[model samples]
Target: MSIGDGYRAVVDLLRHLRFFVAVAETRHFGRAATDLGITQPPLSQGVQKLEGHLGVRLFDRDARGVRLTVAGGRLLGPARALVDAAEDLLDQAGRLGGPVRARVGLCGDLGGWTPVACRALAGGSGPGLVVPRVAGSDRLLAELREGALDVAVVRHPGVVDGLVGGDVVGLPTRLLGADGPLDVPLAEVDRPLVVPPRRHQPPAHDQLVDTLRRAGHDGRVLEAADPTQRAALVAAGAGVALETSPGAQASGGLPPLRVRVVLPAARERRPEVDHAGLAAALEQALRR
Candidate 1:
């Protein structure tokens, strides 16, 4: 093949490699397609094309789902690296034509920590602009996967597949009730547990519910969409809600909820941003 033909072949291979990586990580063509913003047929075809080019079976399809073959497992890391490199090249090229900005997502429950975290990120010498988007943990995760945000402060105990980061900080919480001892046992609260919708942060919601159950509270749960609503419900004698304490020492008796700093797994080591330093700063600021 001519040099031009060879270049086209590599480009074509990279396209297929993206498909391979997505499917490999998600372990399901349907979910991968949705994540990739494509239909299932094209995704399947792209993976098939990649397999044909590599001369190996990458995945075993079964009734349950897809599983990586031995060969696939071996090549997955390298394939991810190549795809990430290509994306980085494009990203850097785009940066050359414009001012650098980092889109950061913060969880809704950060409360007083929100302003501090924003200042920490914006004050950095890294990006020329720091845009902050606030939402629930699940929504933030989706935006990260879709490349809508560069980094996110997400709630712990939630799904973070295909991302890389560490726990940044934890905020202790206290039970807020209209009229009761602050140190009352959860089982003795008598009112329902007021919390946000489970769909917003499924794992954290389940963890909270399970902990309450274990603490002997098997009563009804009142769903509220935001902190204000939860607080209002608590004040109305509807239920007791967990609210972040002013300081670590203020925790009534519940476990602290944690926040983690996560970026796309592919961009974890990108030199454009100092994610670790930002996380450390957040930990310090939030702790105060």
Candidate 2:
């Protein structure tokens, strides 16, 4: 094959690998497609192509769900590395041609503080564009480690292995019930606690549950995917939601949920972007 043909083949292989990794992570074709912003048929075909090229069945699909084969499990690490390396190379190329672009990820429950932080980052005297992605703490950390994100403001008590930073900001949370806001003890409320799924932020979820239990709330816990859903559940009298607010006073309430900025430990790879300076800017933004 000519060099051009080889380059195209490598690109196709990378696409298939990306599809495989997405399906493996989500364990569902439809969900993976949604995450990848593609249709299910194309995603399935890509994964199938990858399996065929590798001469192994990567995923076993049944009526219930998808499960990875042993070969797939073994190849997942290297596939992720390849995908990350490709992305890093593209990012570096972009930086070489233009101003540096910093990608920042923020936790979903930041409420009004999200916009404030975005404005601060965008308006900074920094040299390039500031792009913000919003997601759960777990997703942010994973992206940070994979080199997809330059920095992230994740919830405290997160799994920050291979990353660095510390608590920088705290936002007070209020318990919202069907009638309205409630300032009473959690135990006094005779309803379940509505929160995001534990998988999204394990440490924060476990800590919140433990704290609630100690406060005498031995009730059911409803897991919602986002804050809007949680608030809707509360409004429908399903449960009470702990809603964070930037305007909330911290004088006499439950301890505010803390946020911290973190960057990958391997800073030498992309010396063009000042990760520490960006982190400091984010910390100041969240504080304001």
Q: In candidate 1, where is summed lDDT lowest over 10 consecutive residues?
A: 244-253
**Residue pairs clashing, model 1:** none
* Top lDDT prediction, candidate number: 2
Instruction: Write one digit per residue (lDDT tens) for candidate 1, span 1-288.
Output: 222668788887888889889999999998998777455897899888788888999999989999999999999999999999999998879679676567788888776678777876667543336778988888888777767777888887777777776765668777778874267777787778888788878888888888888887884789877777877888899888777745534545575767788877664435676566655665666667
Q: Would you list the C-alpha lDDT of every candidate in the order shown?
A: 0.77, 0.79
The alpha-carbon RMSD values of the candidates against the true structure, listed in the order shown, are 8.8, 8.5
Determine the C-alpha RMSD for candidate 2 after optimal superposition of all C-alphas: 8.5
How accurate locally is residue 203 in candidate 2, as Cα lDDT from 0 to 100? Answer: 80
Mark the regions of model 1 whose C-alpha exceeds 4 Å error after superposition. Answer: 1-28, 34-98, 123-129, 179-181, 268-271
Q: Give each model a TM-score.
A: 0.64, 0.69
| Candidate number with greatest TM-score | 2
lDDT of 2 by residue, 1-288 (tens): 222668777998988888988999999998887666455897888898777778899999999999999989999999999999988898778868767778889888677788877877778464347889999887888777656888889888876766786665777778878997787877787889888788878888888888888778884689987778887899999998776756665434455777888887864236777787788777877675
